[model samples]
Target: MGDRKDVRPGVGAPAAEPGRVAYDHHWARDLHSSIRCSAAFLALLFAIDWGTGDLTWWRSALWLTLALLLFLVLCPPRVCAGEGWMASRALLRSRRVRTDLLVSVRTLDGVAQLLVLRDAVGGRVEIDPRVLVNNPDLWYRLDEDARKSAASGCLRSGTDTLRHFSERLERETALTVFRISGLDS
Candidate 1:
């Protein structure tokens, strides 16, 4: 993790050896939010039971279990990308795909938007597009590999999708810069 290099221009992220993996910069903050939410939920449950004089050992145990489940549900996977690969890791497992061998990229639209990438070797990973938009370093790694995939003729789908996504990222980046410079008004 410490060896990861970031190539995003104008950002103050530390540079390291090339070819090292890049990770989601916002992962820690999101993880902390998940923890806080689950803890607050547990506290509320306990407070309600105690206030009603219904708290018991068994019930406490149940509440704790519920809180743990809530945390698991709320937790977000950590996303990382290297020269030719991208991965998503959750509490229990990790999914990796060879970005340089990608065959398809699809955007699933529902309650939450998801970007699904499939590789020539049957590797697949579903990730949130916001992760890329928010972390330019990770996006850079993926974009570079996707280009390789395209050049090698392994990528058969989502060229237009990737182009549109790149445009969107550029727009968002510009907007953020404007906001940071107080020129967004």
Candidate 2:
């Protein structure tokens, strides 16, 4: 037992593809939440119409359409990162950026924080920072490529931002490990 090697994969481990890895760990949960929210809204509207005796076929159809719109608004994009690229796909469009060729990174402050990355190739992607916080594998791929960008003098801005973000990620990961090992107390 002492001589046995651990088979668990690490950050540097090769995925099925040589250096390609996609992160969608939270996609299913996000999709389910979107569906639940839309269904609940539709059910509430129908209940109110039925209770008031104002339900009609046209009204039902309108409610369904509204519910679908709500789902579209609530749905989160699927994010994936490979060796040199990251992509976010929504219902209508997909955005991708070359991580290794990144020229700029911008953080937009709003109700939800957005991280915008633009590459030398004119490809750009805007993603929620929480996605990186939740997915270490995705973060690792991006970080590895970003270092390359910096070393190659392609990255012109957001070096401090990436550094701070990486520190935060490290702290979060350490805390999670402590919590899991029952040593957080």
Candidate 1 TM-score, C-alpha based: 0.88
lDDT of 2 by residue, 12-98 (tens): 543444576778799889999999999999999999999999999999999999999999999999999998999999999999999
Native-referenced Cα lDDT, model 2: 0.92
In model 1, how large is the Cα lDDT of residue 75? 98
RMSD of each: 8.2, 7.8
Q: Which parts of model 1 have CA positions greater than 4 angstroms off? A: 1-18
Per-model lDDT: 0.94, 0.92
Clashing pairs in 1: none
Model 2 weakest lDDT span, ten residues long: 5-14
Error of 2 at 125 (Å): 0.5
Best candidate, lDDT-wise? Answer: 1
